[model samples]
Target chain A: MTLTLEKSPLTEAAYYILLSLYEPMHGYGIMQNVKVMSSGRVNLGPGTLYGAISSLLEKGWIISAGESDSRKKEYQITEFGKKAVDCEIHRLEELLANGKKITGAKQ
Target chain B: MKHSTWRWISDYEKEEKWLNEMAAKGMSLYGFFMGKYTFEETEPGKYIYQIELLENFPTSPESVAYLRFLEDTGVICVASVFRWVYLRKEAASGPFELYTDIDSKIKRLSTMKNLWFTFVWLEFIIAAANLAMVIYGWLVVGQMAWFNLGCVVFLVILGLILLNFGLKPARKIKSLKREQLICE
Candidate 1:
């Protein structure tokens, strides 16, 4: 039997965060970048960022980089993270293409 | 009639003197000498001695002489001394009772609050990080389209997992919290 995979809707905030980590960024840097990127739509608290970072680490999507301080840890996305992003882009493209075709047909 | 026997031995010397005296009068000095003595005046003129043994008392002439002197002074030795092990079996139900009632209640409240706080905090951070990525992607790394896509996908997975975990039934979480609270 073929396994049916369900895709979830990406929250605007999460969508933008992954977008921020193209470079090696620390917690504070990530927070600042996200704020600027969203045009002040999302502000990440330290506690919240820490939790997300940990989750990302576990999922193997992000790997730890050299420490910024004794307390602060830096992270960068892994190859797997890059692949996931590619997949998401393809999915988004397919949806867009399908939408265009359907709308074009109606016209 | 119910009678109360309360002896205040303010001075250790006086208490020793009284114990020595009773031991001289054919009272097995073991009970009184070993800090296992219990006194209860069941009647107005009589006191019951139910002594327990914690350690071995010294049997020496000096101790015997002290006992003799006290016995000669008309102190009555009412009971025979018996040797027993003071078995201190703690009430098995005591800690469990504490755990279930006081410990469990406090733990549940604190844990629920903590879990909720953690869930909210995680959600916020994931949201914030995602926002940052978007802005940086647009401004700094417009050319790094591949990397930007990866970050988005990773975050989407993380968000879904977090939301699922946060929304899952909190019964197990509640129990774990209770356990931690009780232990503390």
Candidate 2:
């Protein structure tokens, strides 16, 4: 299935997970990085991360990196993942723009 | 010192909570088989426990790979009974949670509900078969198999118990679905 933002919006947990994968990290690293990137606002649980990684990998948005001699498997975001991220960013920008326009809120 | 205890907890969520409570009191669970729990002495509040209903038998390769992934996240698989895996991580390691969002929670609960529902139906069918055979022996045939009536009674009771077990998770899934709508 095409994981396009227009088709189905990304959950906050999923969005942060893909964002954290640009650095090619393992499971625990991804969880920690997501937590830090979101300023501790988003804590990705182990089970949720496992499920998201499996889905993202199946969707061709991420690829498993070669084993780094450690038991932990690493993953890196692919071009498809970047494309998905871009699509989501545009959608989010549109949401912000429309909300601000109506609320007369300052950036 | 190792401590062993037996507690039959039907609901996974309540079992997880009870295990965590035991961990907070310095009893870290290290083994579990069926309803028996084995714990080892540890520092108070040193660990957090989580239980999951696996999609297949825990010994299956699929579940093994899944558990390996969880281990990489600092959660170790302590034990498994059938499809139920018992996991724990040190409480010193920030915070540990198996599910962070409602979607995954709902999915897990649905899995549990479906499993119980299957068992309930299986038991119910067996009870019906036994009853039919008993009637056939008494009327259609010439033998008196009144003793089989007792077996049918036992199976029916077991099936009813399982039906009750299935309903708890079904209710949980229903509320979770409502929460999903509100969140969206």
Instruction: Give the TM-score of each candidate.
Output: 0.33, 0.92
Best by lDDT: 2
List-wise, what DockQ does each model earn? 0.01, 0.76
TM-score of chain A of each: 0.69, 0.87
**Tens digits of lDDT, candidate 1, B54-108:** 1122244633332232233222233233322211111221110111222233443
Indicate the worst ten consecutive residues by lDDT in candidate 1 chain A. A1-10
Q: Write the per-residue lDDT of candidate 2 for residues B1-184, one digit (tens) a residue.
A: 9999999987777889999999999999999986789999999999988888899898889898999898887889999988888888888888888888998888788888899899988988888888888989988897877778888989888888888888998998888898898683
Which segments of candidate 1 are over 4 A away from where they belong?
A1-11, A69-71, A99-107, B1-184
CA lDDT, every model vs. true structure: 0.48, 0.86
Q: What lDDT is obtained when candidate 1 is compared to the true structure? A: 0.48
Clashes of each: 16, 0
TM-score of chain A of 1: 0.69
